[model samples]
Target chain A: MCAKDETSRPKMAKPGRSFTTLLFFVCCLLCLLLTRGQKDERMSICHLSSCGSPLADDGKVYGMCQGRHGLQVWGRCCVNVTENTHNFTVGLDLSGCNIHDEFFQESPLLTLTHLQALVLDNNPITVLSSEAVAGLTELNYISVPTHSNCSCPGGEEAWNHLIRSVNTTLCLKQTSTCTRYNEACPASSSHCVEDGPGLFLCLCKEGYHGYKCLRQGTFPMSAFLAGLGSSTVILAAVLWVLLRRHVKTA
Target chain B: MASISQMWRQLKSKYSIYHVFVFLLTFFSYAFFHATRKTFSNIKTTISSEWTPQFCNATEPCLRPEKIWMARHLFDSSSDAEPFLGWLDSTFLISYAVGLYISGVLGDRFDMRKVLSLGMCLSAIVVFVFGCLTEWIHLYSQPVYVILFVLNGLLQSTGWPCVVAIMGNWFGKSTRGLVLGAWSACASVGNIIGALLVSQVLDYGYEYAFLVTSAVLFAGGIINFFALVPSPKEVGLPEPEDGDDDDDDSEPSGEEDENGVTPRTPLVQTDTDPPVTFTQTRPQAISFFQAVLLPGVIPYSLSYACLKLVNYSFFFWLPFYLHSQYGWKETVADEISIYYDVGGIIGGMIGGYLSDRMKKRAPTVVTMLLLALPSLWGYSASPNNKTINAVLMAVAGFFIGGPANLISSAISADLGRQDLIKGNSEALSTVTGIVDGTGSVGASVGQIVVPLLHKQLHLDWHWVFYFFILMTLLTAVCILPLLVREVRSMKCFLNYQLRRQAAALVQDTHRPHSLNS
Candidate 1:
């Protein structure tokens, strides 16, 4: 009876479920089309006369555009940005820009072959990826929300992933705690850092010490004692010679 | 404790051990002197790089520019700065040369050990002050540095003459050549050690180089005072019996003798008689002019002057020249230049050994000088090939170092034993002083001229080599008259031998006839 009831319940709910599924499929199709259209509009806008212009900040959005003069469109600076001009930009400061994976993948940053520094301060960018910095051959430094101490979900992991993927130095805002900083250790030294039980501990190599392995290990006490011992013997010999000369003269 | 006299007697029984100890002491002491002296040359590149205005300024500040004390005043924008650097070197060398004669005379008159210790102590003080001027004192005044360096130079001059005299007292003329030649290598060894020390410490700071050198010199001076037995008589041992044509009148102080003491001399001997004593009595020391008039003294002195001119030029300018000509790194150029010192060591030993075996000091020196000429030309004119430059440089060093070492050591020792002096050993220091002093003057001139030609005259490196070649040729020529005298005397001796042989034959024939009659 239980089995029969269970089977009958599914049969009754089937039609409704099917209708719902169909409706959901149609909604997804519409949303996808709309998203495609929006993407097309965004790309068209990027390619147009103000292709590299920074997006306007209406007390909300913050983005930089390679304007006629330089990187512009920061609140008030956006107004003076000359229109109908494009430049081969070298740097992009996207401070306070609300960015995501899509913004990273589709942003004009990719077009700037000469980009050196990327500033993403005060941003809610939680989906940074290697693709964002992939072709930036000249990129040397990158700044992120680490400075703003913004508490975004998976923000630390996002920065870690991005930094791991890129070769340049990632300048996290001063608030970011070093989880696994390799820079703490010099090339000649080995070091270990202990955060917690599950956290990996960095162990320094021989003849080096400290969490960062900055200080070189000193000579062993035995070596110092040996040096002292030899020096004493030599001093004694010198004394013996001097005394002997004195005795002879006397 | 045993009575000091008893202990001393026990130690003196092992007189040969004392001899070896004294030898080692003099060797290391002079080497220490040279090492300290060379600290400046070894770190010259570091000084120039660290202090040059081009290396630091308001617009383009150097790494830790504040740490440099002399940068703004001594090495900055004035066009005269570079040329004045040459003068700094000259100040030291000229003072050293002038101080040579005075120190030599003092060395002869005073206790050698006292003189050496005093010199070492003063040098250490000056070098330490030089370091402090840059490090702690921060006195960037150039003239102050020059004055300190001049004092250092004068003190350094005390090293060579005093060490040679002490060693002369220990070893006789028989083994003097090889012993002094090998021993004179203290210069090159000290130079190499200095280069290594300065190179290592330069990473920390340039001032440390001078400080470390001073510390070593101070320690060495103390050790030298304790360990050095300036004369055998002071240790109650008989004099070494190694002088030319001198017969031993005193009992030979053999190893088998249970007691170390030898009896007093039998009698006073005339000047015409063969020297028959290794007596410890103070002999009349010759005047400086008399020492200069000794056979082979003037020629060897002149030759040494030229040789030193060439040597000092290389000493002061080789690394700089290599850097400018080939764009090599300063450290690499300095490392390569050290090989020249290695060649010098080998050359000095070879020259000494050959002179001893051939029993002719002048010819050996002349041959080495002549060989150096071609090597100098090649080293100067060679293309910027590292391998070729290194080999030629080593070859030039080998030849240049040979005569330079021989003239100052074995030749001076030989002149000091001049037959006219009648075995007055104290003259050794004076003769060594005169020869090395003249050489020091030439070294001073070389230190100035190399820079003048390179920077002021704006001549190519080839011109520097031309100066070297001319000096080499002149050195060989300076000794030419002596070489001629040696050859002419050899010819006369051979002729006399031939005539005697013929007369012997006739006498033998006459003896047979007279016996039959």
Candidate 2:
């Protein structure tokens, strides 16, 4: 087999050994190399019909699409935006829509945590807790301001602090949820500091912190006892099984 | 004492021990093959995202290019990177297809254990080097990436034939369909693992995808080297009766019984005879063309080509289509697409089990391919509901996965044992290689054509799916001749039996008349 291969090798190398063959190979190589450098054109979310309301809709707000006018919008609704929203959807403008609490609850916006600028400028929406607005740490520009009726559990002072931490220029004030302060802070808490007419801050005496000052700071003795009991039971069961096997063998 | 003794006995049993080792070692070894290949899709996405840095930057200025796609000038000069990336995949696949043929030949002549392990190790080294070029050193040459991928493709080709041939040696024809079916799921398992690994590490650095995958391949190679026994004889166990052992002069004389049949050496020795020392020779290697000429080889090969085309198109493009057509988030699209593979795992087992029970490989495959046509059409035309899509994807997966697994593994094994080959066991690997090699060519074509079809159809995903529906129908058609032949043989068999019964009745009447006379 080795001798046969050796004889065959020289025969192949002897023939078709021309400059043109080498040139043809080089040309093919060149074409592939040239084509490799080419890059695909970037796709824009603004071009997609799912990014904006259809033109046939009764209320065609330019703000919904960031004032990019004259773009063609077919009759495709953004029905499955969580599954349909483009990865590059940074600026979402739902400014003039009457988006109530149900809108937030039902909308797929929560899944689009990659958003950079979320503008709910003039909507009649009230945020009751930081929990409602959490998980979107990637947001650079959030505009749910006092003017838009957007408020949190913490009053104007707390809202301002939230805005500062997010590093956005949106100034949202405390809402009616703060005015009903008796129910806001837990009864077992120590002091409630009112910043404004509608806003109050809870100050727990000790061994407690949180929005309602309801969370106990100390570790739970019951959980410790339960863990200890379970471990002991498991250990005892294992030992019993081992002992039974050993006794039988003996 | 009784419990301990029982436990030890169970461990010493054949079905409970050695066979399980062979099954797992082969299963994971092939899965590693798929795991390494699975990284391509994720890497493709990374390349596209990186090429459009300006767009990504506009979305979020802080976002950086994936290190895997940071190789300069590869996609920077062109208007679209899809064409180039498609070609890169094609280069790998074409080389792979070519390498499959060569590897099959080598596997026949050489020790499969070494071939498979060395292939894995080389594949690991190539992938590791490829990753380092992209991530650590940032080597920015198109030729470098292309050449490395092509090399990896050739190395990757060695896995399927070697594992299949080794598996064929252990399990008999009776249980082959079911065993191979379960075993074939390594591809889907590897796909899930690869997809998950890339997605998880994608945020950290794209290079880790390749780095981690290379590590897996290396570990698999090491395992393959140590754990894999190419044939049952290597471990002093009985080779399954495939009717080929008579022609196999490779076994030492000491192992042969009085009738000259080598009795199956039990995996665990019950008798206290001293361990037999035997020098076993290898069966003569069959030629490539001869292996291809074996009965059922050509038709199955052609059919497998089409099946692979459809399957691989989904493997590479399903996520991209979901993302683009429905405007789905990349991650969500990736998650949803795994349903296809999940469906495939179940489909493979079903296909294998059905074929085994029916004892007709071609007809079983034909049924699967026929069923798959409607599933593809339904999936394409169905609404973009997640639950509906999930159901449809699984159903499609079952039908397609069944035939794909059946034809390549069990059917190939059956064909390799055809009387035309004189039951030469060494030819099984070569036949497997030829059939799957042909399929890999279709896979290569799929990698190229799917993208082109997507381009030609103006990026409408519906038309792309229509093409798949057509391919499924074509695959069913390829198996029609085989199904026809099986039916005819069955009819002939029935006719012969009826004639013999009629003759026996006549003989009974004539005997009574003669006795009376």
Candidate 3:
């Protein structure tokens, strides 16, 4: 009778168990689809515009896009495809793109954290504030229209060299934004460090932690040493006893 | 009361008790010395940041800014303290290399226990004053730091030769490889201890790190001064037998006599046959020139230098490489780099055991070094996988560090008591110093060259790995002659064993026929 009941229980629960199993698979499928959609949205930035037949000579940006290995030109952008999954935008040439101050304020280019060489020559943009290049820490070479009065992101002092040519004003070697915000960390136990262009972070000193860096104290050295010392003594005594027979005495 | 007295007498009579005591005392003494040395590297970043003038502001106002009011204010505008720190390191290395030669001569002449304890105590005080007292007193002078580091380097130089000499006196050649291999892990252990102690106290102030390490080192020095037994003769125990007579016990019977490779001349008679009065004669210490011309000293020293260059490059640059390449946080990178040292400790033990089993040091060292090339190359080529990187780094570390440890500890001990030295244990300290001093110079050169290759020359980071591979290859090349000799001796030994077994089998068959006749 017990065997018959056990055999019948599976028959009775099969439909409901199958239904839950189907639901679990459906939920997993939905998660995969959502992640795939997000990935597509991220990759769409590369295909937003088409590349010109003869790429405009934007100096370093053009050279990087054309000459660098593992980097391919994709719709006016030089994307790094070395990792296969994550395509980092390393160089972007936006010559004659009709970009303005508004485009700098809320452009897709701001999402490219790894952007190094950016060319915005022949654009309508006149003034580029520090906020416009806020997250671009790796940027070393940037070009603006020659008519623009916008100095470098953190001003001329923050850059190594500034060149004014016929079509563009190029800023080379943008030093860290920490140079301008050197005194940002006000607490005695904190220091300001550069995170990116126009970005700074406050880090607590070594022993100090928690809110405003007030917490302090060192490792429990006394307790630790006592434990280590006692264990060593015991082990040494054991070794002495074990090797007694082997030792040659006078 | 009677039982307690009897037990005390029994313990005192056993020579093993003294052996254990000396091992523990010397082990901790050297570990303390290394811990103090390691503290500087661990706290370098904190020191550099504190040195920067910009660190002085409204709220954090640099501690005693008036103290640093010099005419030049060299670090006033620039936030980078790397170049100054580099100069400090170079100053220490230069002084340390020079001091090692002098310390070697002094160690053989003086009581080793006194020399070791005094050096440790003095170095502790210097470190404490340089690191901790200066912070308390608000003394911030560049020249003063340089002077203190130079002094500290000379004092620290006394540590290695004295400890190695003392160890050579206590341990005989039979188990020297296994014993010293295990013992040599003090350096890596010291590094870990320093890092832990510093990390614990760094948040309060960098000075606390120095304070703790110096205190520990000072305590070790005091203990060593009171309890250390420098040699067996000091306590009226029998001197250990050198490998000359015991070689046959561990190997085939006829090998040593037939090949005449290693001279079995018992220069110092063992206590086994007749009780020789040790007080009647003492072996004189060899000079620097004489020690240098010893059979295996020059090649081993050169090999050690090349091996140390590669070892120290990883020691100095591993964290920086991890942070830059993998974008790991500073602390994470530092923690990950420790796996290399862990691999080193294991490798040293294995290398020692293998050399002891084969009764050959050079072959084991050369094999590990040759294997290191591929591990290094694999480490460089492995894609940004943390597990793979760590495993390969450990493998590279094993291959590199195994031979380096063997050469410095057991090989140094072996070379010191070689047949040419005539069992004059007094020369042990000088031989150890020459090898280690040359290795320190090589490490200094590496510190300069590693930075030059990647930073100054503006080459890719991969160039550093290529240079490491080259260094590993050079280390093997330097030990090639030693490897050849060891291999030839081993072949001869094996042939003798095979012939003896064949003769025994023929004798077994002829015994029955003779009985029937």
Candidate 4:
């Protein structure tokens, strides 16, 4: 018999189909949420190796990965540089590197504005200089920690001094000493603050503030906060209906 | 009520040609819907390229545009990339399979016109919105961008069911193949448009092209809303009442079903003829949740997924294959591949015409599919050599693309039996959704699996053609028996009985093909 029934639904259906339907929707919601959750996860990665440094496309670079020697381009290139948008971090896993200026020229800690960290713990970074870090004004952490026999004139001390010169408020000095000297040092560019040795923090420059401290905003905090509150409730209501009713059906 | 109604009987009035007018209008509406639905498939290159520089290529610039989910993939590891592509495709396929069961229920329970229109509008909006998203959001991870495209797939699922519902309502047994085949051809046409337009836009900017294509579907949505009429009954007319003048038996009172609930006409009417019937009202509507469980939906849904795997693989990979195997760029490869679509247009017309004339749309699909299987082999084995493979591929396109529409459109129509079921044409769309959604799942599968196989086979990307060949063969063999039943349903196939009835005229070999029965 041709049992392709159009007239009536099968009576006494088991609970199995419903379970499947529920599972199906659960998967869809999870996919949507997971995709939404991974917004700004970085695509640039530095594979740690002994001889090779991650290739940076050369000094006058439009794309960061353009000149890096060992660095491979992945799915799509995400870095397009602009005035206020440079949150990409250049990580140095010198756990096994014989550091040459190719490291500096390629990732010349100087050019990166929002450079966050530089780690050369187990590397032979014998000759370090300020010119090597020509453009890196906004570096926060430069850990060359635990050197058995360190180089450079002041060793860690000269590096500390370099951090201090970048911003008078920033130094290799202890926090207690810095707090005492705070009054003596006039905050010239209030946007700049010293964080560590050869590292200072850049306060989102000005007229711009977002998650990565990237996007520019027109309104102030109080007005934006008020707008946020009303919209939050509305967004919540809409999400609830979409997730609850439509999710169940869609 | 209106003067138009009152004056209608006085004016030169015959409801039959009005049937023809509605038929033509409905057919065109279905065609336009197909055109718009297809607008997105071709633009893969554009959207992929546009989102590329913005997203950091996750690993490499301009990899596979076929990998819908990999738009979110972030790592540069090729090892990780291939497997993840596979996983993502599985995700899409699983969701598609899950979605299929309920799609039928949704169409049946809801007003299919509104449902289909809403789906198109939303798809357009989602695609357009996703297009605009290239400008706004810049989250560059495997998870982030993948979600956007996944949503795109989910929304796109609505198109098949909607179009199917429309096609089912408008055609019947005699012309089902021809009509459905034409509808499927529209799908190919949409892809062709999608490929050309997307490539063109990508050359300029990826964002604008995506936005434009997505937004254009709104036009289709609007047309579908005004143009889709459920059946002839919706406009206060009867079926085309073809009233062919050669009936010998005393006629049954066709008027008996005027109350709109018609019983199934018994098969005893003639063992020598393909049964002909007219539209009768459906018993009632089933709710969306309960519709999938209504038997045959899941089985058909599974077969649809299998059938789609071959087709979808071709959809996503054909351009890339052409480019890699031949010395061609993405744009050139994509453009040239459209010849396949052109052949599809011809194949669909031919298949449909044959099916309608012979009353065996399903068999036409089986036959073309069988022909396509070896063509896939020929295409895969000899892609570079022009004399053999290129011609073979065009031939493959003819059969493959032709049958695709014939089965999906006319077969779905025959399955719906709108003539038997009456006003419940809405479920037809849901069944369509289930079928096409199943196919989308397969497409996602092919997108992932073909690439993985290509890598494994270590053959130059010709593995895509190979995959199509194997799958096409399997699908053909599996559906061949279905064709046997399909042939028997043909009024012409009952040759022994027809010859017995007209022994005097039996030797007359000059019977017009149209009157073979």
Best of the candidates, DockQ: 3
**Error at B233, model 2, angstroms:** 2.0
Docking class of 3: incorrect
Flag the better candidate by TM-score, 2 or 4. Answer: 2
- Badly placed stretches (over 4 Å) of model 4 are A1-250, B1-97, B139-142, B199-204, B239-283, B286-303, B383-389, B418-426, B457-467, B488-500, B503-517
Model 2, stretches more than 4 Å misplaced? A1-250, B1-16, B45-74, B77-80, B243-267, B270-279, B422-425, B457-460, B494-517
Candidate 1: tens digits of C-alpha lDDT, residues A1-250: 2223322321233345877556544543554466564323322323343224444353111233443343443221221223223223444555544555456556445455555456555556654554455445455446555422323222344233344223222533222222434443233544434221112123456755422332244424365446645674596386445422421231
Give the native contact fraction of candidate 2. 0.00
iRMS values in order, in angstroms?
A: 11.6, 18.2, 9.6, 19.2
TM per candidate comes to 0.61, 0.59, 0.63, 0.54
Report the poorest 10 consecutive residues by lDDT, candidate 2 chain B. B61-70
Question: What are the DockQ scores of the candidates, in order?
Answer: 0.02, 0.01, 0.04, 0.01
Chain A TM-score across all models, in listed order: 0.29, 0.31, 0.61, 0.30
Per TM-score, the best of the predicted structures is 3
Candidate 1 Cα outliers beyond 4 Å, as residue runs: A1-250, B1-15, B45-84, B241-281, B492-517
lDDT of 3 at B82: 74
lDDT accuracy of residue B130 in candidate 3: 94
Best-fitting candidate, scored by lDDT: 3
Q: How good is the docking of model 4, by CAPRI class?
A: incorrect
